[model samples]
Target: MPSSVCIMEDPPVDRLTSPILKKYYPCPNASPGYFSLRHKFRSLFQLPRIHASELPVQQNKPVSPADALTAAAESLQKKVVQNKSLISEVEIQQFLSSETGSDRLKRMYTKDVDGFQSPELWFIGQSLLKICGMTFLITSYIGGKHGGEKFAKENQATAFRTQFQASRLRNDHVVLAGMKSGFIWTYRVGIFSSIFLFLSQSIAVYRNKSSVMEYVIASGVTGSLLKANLGPKGMMSGGVFGSLMGLVGGTLIYGFMLMTNETQEQRHYWNIQKYLEVQRELNKGGD
Candidate 1:
């Protein structure tokens, strides 16, 4: 009789099908060589292997259109509320505080000043002062000229003719007549010019826009009106001259503002540099 042999064999473990390995490495048919290389890498890095059960499951629930819109609206409302909160009582108080007289005067020349009864009044006052002063100086100079003196004397004679004593007028009277003529001219030009300019600028400000065109239009209109007593040729010439002057003045002002802004930026940069230097010195001393 032949002897019978008994054999026992253990089943191979399917590591790729395990919950932990399957969660991390999804490929079930991966080669044993690849697994060995991964194991070597993990060992070299000394990385801890995390189990699938240790991770929390994250479910991506579908969002509805209405829900998305509601969320967006809520976010927008929150942002508006946050922005509103940024402007505080202290800021309002500071903005409303009284300004110095000199500061108010300065702003009158460039921008509308606060604490005034009316912005229009402020603009009117500024225009009056500037235009009147310029006109006074110009008319006085012109009146001192030879032709201007003769013209004034003629006017004085005409006036005194009603008294029947034209030749008997004093030197002081002639001088007074000349001054009177200058005053009349100054008033005519200055008052009308100021009114036109103020109206033009106010319109621009109201429209939330200001440009060289505003000045040009104002000056042209004022010049045309002033020369209306003369022929159309005079009116045209006056308008052209005024427009040219306005253009030159506006360009100069814009250039000046640009230079001022550049200077201010440079000053701010220097101030920051100085502050940084001081901070560094203090830190070094502390160390």
Candidate 2:
């Protein structure tokens, strides 16, 4: 009878209601909160990031025409409006008063026939000298007399000449050939220089540098060293490459020197010029 009574009393069920059990039991239903908020919190702590190798990578989506147009419009608007950050009034006045700044500003705004010609002629002369210098240095180091003789022979064979019968008959063919060889070599040097300038322009943009001067210097130095390593046969090829680099470096240095004296007006002009270029690029993409 005692056993039956004890069983019926629920065997001290209140003992199961101890604070420790009660605390763990019921597990207060964790109200499933915002999944996105939880995910964000996880990300913030870098706690549950999926490994890159765990999932298939999705390819980058191509930018749509509408997105491109919107980007261009934004750029154009940003540029057209005066951005005081790019050019301030105090800086402009200072640049305008400076000799170098004045000259650069003039060149940008007004057409000066002489201004363009002077610089062009100077560059041409420099290129010619560079070609001659490289040819001498490389040949002297390698084949010595033999290399000189070979160059002469090649020049004589390949030199430019008049197509007219009368000119071809002249006894001065050798002299004309030599002159043509010089001209051809000069033209090659010029071409290499132009290529360097174009490449460095892209580099400057990529680096977000205010000046392309550093690229120019680095290219020339690298090209010279590389050419020197190639021996005598590389004279023509290496010289052209080196000259191109030199021109770029020289131009960068020169431009920076001038930019040092830039005033408020000069800054404003350059800012506008940069924006216009951005607009042109945007237009190209739209088309």
Candidate 3:
């Protein structure tokens, strides 16, 4: 048998009909050179080539602290101005003119105005101070009377009645005992007066009216209750005396307010007006 001759041939050109295959495999008849598959695909996809110069370049500039702060402040100010513009002058005027129940209460109490203490605390403190002064004066007068002999005698009598151990009652002991009595009286008076004033003020706030009548009613009720341990006659006497005192005090206060022309509503109005004016000035400056 004759040996068979080996035969070699190139792959068929028809096999490279696909663009991808044609890109990878060049025809045998073509010249020997590099054919970039990348460019070929780029052209096929219609992608444009970009140069470095055509790209956007950002330069890093150094900013000073002051400039940064000023920029931030300007932006904040602009935001504030925009917010303020949303509130019209007519709305502000309406808000200024209108008074709600809470506003009236705050005005009556003067809670947030002009460094004034709260009404409850102020009245209670005043009552405490008044009681303390009265107690000091009365105790001093009693202790000094008859060279404190009378007070010493009274202390002895009290100790004897109470069956307390006997100590030779001295002038100092008498003074101390008198002070104790004064303290008790002060506590009672201070508590009662504070309660009376608080009730009167609260009633006035509730009714949205400040007048003498509320004080009179509060004092009468408080006085009667304070003396309830006694008989009806004591209550009646206390109520009458309290009412008279209330009338005098209330009249004096009302007269003072009238003379000074310093009412809560008027003060609040002025404060609001000033605030509105300041805001208007700020808006004008912003504009």
Candidate 4:
């Protein structure tokens, strides 16, 4: 049994050398502790080592057509909900009937009046007052003292006759003749004044460049001046020139007053109509 004694010892390091095995071996000059600790840490944690093929490749996510449509519908519904009561009829009516609305209407138009008010009386009074003042100025100032005296003397007889038979003055042949002449002159002045005022107001409205009241006043002044300068003379001379001016001035003034008043009233009516329209719209709902 003691024929052969085989020997077992560590393999020669130099004889077992290989390039791949070299990595597993410690460097000849390096400390073995450093490599030992690194190996121990890597083994303890078992940290994952990544490879290019193992990485997740990112790609754009696909959107379904139905999902997009659903999103659009949701957005549309949100908008509709937000604007649901935007044109409410009740709200519009309340706004129009409010104090603020009344104030605005007042500024744009005229006062709202109920019951009976005599526009006829207002026109007549304005006409007469304006005529009286105009007559005095033209006869006394513009006509000169001598012309004024002549007018007074001529009218003196008519004046006396009027005083005695005031009721008959409208019918008496002599007085009627005088009145006829006066009426002709008055008619001419009134017509001219009316034309001037109408044209002025119409132009202002058409252009929207000037205020209606401004044109009214201009027409008034111009009519008065024209009456004073170019008014007729002869039998109706005494204080009559200024009277003619007043007549014309009154015609324009009163006419304009009535016109503006009526216009304002119409505006108020129109606003009421607009309110009704808004109410109708609100009733329709969900536009």
Candidate 5:
């Protein structure tokens, strides 16, 4: 009877509240908090925070055509007004000094043009010379001789307005040609100098030959290049090539006209003649 009473009082038989049986225990290794956050996020009506670094970098907005044109027009007007103001001042002075109407107008235009030319000319001249020098050097180095002179002659700055043109500069061909010229000219000068020394027996010819050629080529080419407003490399190609060509042509003419004295039989005779001539000259000086 006591056993039956214990069985009737057993803890209300609720499955959720019942003590866990060791045989049917749940897995402890499974994720516990993973689903909780996801569930809570789904239930909430808020957005997730994103880092600032996750956003793309922004670039500056480009200037519109209207804006650019407006800016240029405004800048030009400013310059024009400045010039006109100066002309007005000059005109007032001229009129006050008893100048005629046409004379005053002439003076104003002249003053403005002159004013613009003076400063701008100085700026353009410096830039032209620099570009020309570079063109000359580079061209001569690459194109041998022709490259240097062509630039030296053609691209010269005849007017200040030419600077604005992009076409008036060294091209790739001139530069490549200039490099070729440098190698060839150096070799030509060396061989020619040796020949000059042998013929004239002049130490000065052999020693200063390279400098002489460079100077000769550099002068006409460099100065003409200044006028041409050409690139340095192109100028170099022209000058070196031109001068060397002249030298080669001159050599060919001289070669055909000269008599050949090179013979085994005459070799000793020529040597003795030279030796005796030297001895006689020495003896005359009391050697």
Candidate 6:
């Protein structure tokens, strides 16, 4: 009998439809070129392809109940294999860098961030946030207490305006006297612009739709303006930039008063007169 003819062909793919087969899904010893290809081959039989965002994405392989226990055991074995110092620098650093997967993840994140903030400060902030709904306490005090929640809060904005004026006058006196005490003293050079930006933010919060957004925008403006006022070195290193910042600050703050509506007391006094006239007419009608 004649030997049977052997036919071999390259496996057909969606992109390449060829009867001639050069290789299977992956050639033996083929470089793990793309991560996608490596992962694809690893779970090619286990995972299902799903259409997502117009891309063919592989969904997670379904794990059997037995597989879950097996995985958990493997995880425990991995934990055992990891080397851990009895006591570590991690403890001194206020965090644990252990064999624990969660700790490792946290350590990685902290490393990437380059030690963002102090734990002590974080605790203090948490305590204050819980004690008072003061998300922007630092901001409130910096503006000479002329703006923020006190002034433009709860439709009692008139109260805020009066308080703000009083605060500005106090700061003006401080600046004129060269009285450097507290934040006012420390940031005295830019105090003028400080007041102005405060008033602007306050007005925006009270009159505009979103107070938070106004302040967020204000913060960016304030930082730039503050830098201009202080310059590279700062107040004692007072340059032309510092002088300009102070001038701008003063103009903005007092100008806001000139631009806005009348004080609450003045408006109330006018309304009272109208009320008295109405009362007199009602009494006359009864008579």
lDDT (Cα, tens digit) per residue for candidate 2, span 166-230:
33433245444445565555555545555554444334333424354545554664465457657
Q: What is the C-alpha lDDT of each candidate?
A: 0.58, 0.50, 0.64, 0.49, 0.44, 0.42
Residue ranges of candidate 3 with Cα displaced over 4 Å: 1-120, 140-147, 151-169, 231-233, 264-287
The most accurate candidate by lDDT is 3
Clashes of each: 0, 8, 0, 3, 44, 7
Kindly report which residue stretches of model 4 are placed more than 4 angstroms away from their true locations once superposed.
Answer: 1-174, 208-287
Residue 141 Cα positional deviation in candidate 2, in Å, after optimal superposition: 26
lDDT per residue (tens digit) for residues 1-287 in model 6 = 22232222222233232322222333333232443464456565676766678786789998999999999999977875562222233332332122343433232233222345323234334554443333233433545344333333434424445767866755565343332233343343244334434544344323422223333344445545556666655533343444455456545644564557433223323433433444545665667
Candidate 2 TM-score, true structure as reference? 0.27
Model 4 worst lDDT run, 10 consecutive residues: 1-10
List the candidates' TM-scores in order.
0.39, 0.27, 0.46, 0.23, 0.18, 0.17
Pairs that collide in candidate 1 are: none
- Ten-residue region with minimum lDDT total, candidate 3: 1-10
- Output the number of the TM-score-best candidate: 3
> Over all chains combined, what TM-score does candidate 3 have?
0.46
Cα deviation of 42 in candidate 2 (Å)?
Answer: 99
Off by over 4 Å in 6: 1-193, 196-207, 229-287
Better of 2 and 3 by TM-score: 3
> Which 10 consecutive positions of candidate 2 have the poorest summed lDDT?
3-12
Error of 6 at 216 (Å): 1.2
Better of 1 and 3 by lDDT: 3
| lDDT tens per residue, model 4, 169-218 | 33354443444445555556555545554444444333323334534444
Q: Pairing residues by index, what is the TM-score of model 5?
A: 0.18
Best first by lDDT, ranked: 3, 1, 2, 4, 5, 6
- Winner of 3 and 4 under lDDT: 3
In candidate 1, what are the lDDT values of residues 190-229, reduced to their tens digit? 7676756675655444333345676677777777777878
